[model samples]
Target: MTQDPSRADMEAVAEQVFVALADPSRRSILAALASGGPATATDLANRLPITRQAIAKHLTLLTDAGLVTPEHGERRRVRFRLHSAPMQVAQQFLAAMARDWDSRLDALKDHLER
Candidate 1:
């Protein structure tokens, strides 16, 4: 049986996702992958204004963050495919934080209304 990830693990993954997403270039790369599907660094360069070297760098970071997976294609080409698991973990983290804040804020409003 597979064990579920601990909260710490989830937070760590979420942190990596957040750091990876902090860059506009990385975000653009992700958006391109989302719209165009899996693509090589050269393919991304062709689609985005970013250079091939820069896209390769951004792809490295995205791979490290578990945002994308590299697949070997014909002629030894590496195509990057979007991976949403880490992003989902980050979304869960944000949702949990929002829930906590919502409850606290509701309590504060109730206290002030009294």
Candidate 2:
């Protein structure tokens, strides 16, 4: 397989994902869309305590991070839905980090035992 990019780029992508997930309200918004399928900001507003305006702001961030996609609807209504691509990339990055740490620990253990 191809080697992963430099740490700087990986960190940037991870940072974006982390920032998108940092807000509790955004997480709720993601969960709502994930569970309820694609929906408008108004639809999400009804299901969540936050106002539609707030949800719209959160959606903008999500879209920027590639976590959510917006579908243009009739009458200027836009539907937002969870996009798994960014999350999948983030998950893979975390798993790779875990594996690297595990290998480093194993090497340390070998050195101490020597």
Candidate 3:
């Protein structure tokens, strides 16, 4: 069954999502996850310049951020998949920020024109 997220939960989720995306390495990880269905730390490390250990750390952060989840597959291999809900929240937050900036800019323009 699905559970609806509360306001505080959404705020927490959004904070974590933004924090995860703030790092370039994490963003790269997310990109990789988006391109590929799921990948192990070793697989991601092989694709990127970072070491497997570093990749694992990034994966941990992403997992804690609720942007990704690990699934067991093929023995001890742990694969991660993107969780798009928080991403959608991040996108909406960004869009809202953009809109607010636009409004402020429009007001500034009007003030300058007067």
Candidate 4:
């Protein structure tokens, strides 16, 4: 069946979020931001075991995925802030799929009981 364009766009975003979250380092970076608020790559590197350069690389991917946004802070330091919209969209996508499966299972149960 054909999918709606909006649905397709959301699915694409959710896919990006999933891809970004697939990396453990990326997840740790996000967790650090969530717990400590916005921070630069150096700050994340200090908090986590990853190097500054590696954190910077992961931050780039996170920014592309809309999982994090960069803001210029004092001294022009770019701080990465966690953005939850893409993740929320992904959660909604999973919820929709789960609902679809639940309805199908319920229908099968009813049919078997008949």
Candidates 3 and 4: which is better by lDDT?
4
- Candidate 4, residues 21-113: lDDT per residue as tens digits? 999999999999999999999899888999999999999999999999999989989999999999999998888878989999999999999
Model 3, range 1-114, lDDT digits (tens) per residue? 454465446657778998998999999999988998699999999888889999999999999988899999888899999989888877776676689799999999999999
Candidate 4: regions farther than 4 A off: none
Ranking by TM-score: 4, 2, 1, 3
| lDDT at position 21, candidate 3 | 86
lDDT of 2 by residue, 1-114 (tens): 555566556656777888999999999999998899999999999999999899989999999998889999999999987898778777777987899999999999999999
Angstrom error of the Cα, residue 107, model 3: value is: 9.8
lDDT of each: 0.95, 0.88, 0.87, 0.94
User: Native-vs-model 1 lDDT?
Assistant: 0.95
Worst 10 residues of 3 by lDDT: 1-10
Q: Which pairs, if any, clash in model 1?
A: none
Deviation in Å, model 4, residue 2 alpha carbon: 0.7
Candidate 3 stretches greater than 4 Å from native: 1-5, 95-114
Which has the greatest TM-score? 4
User: Candidate 4, overall lDDT?
Assistant: 0.94
Q: Which candidate is the best by lDDT?
A: 1
How much is the lDDT of residue 109 in candidate 1? Answer: 100
TM-score of 3: 0.75
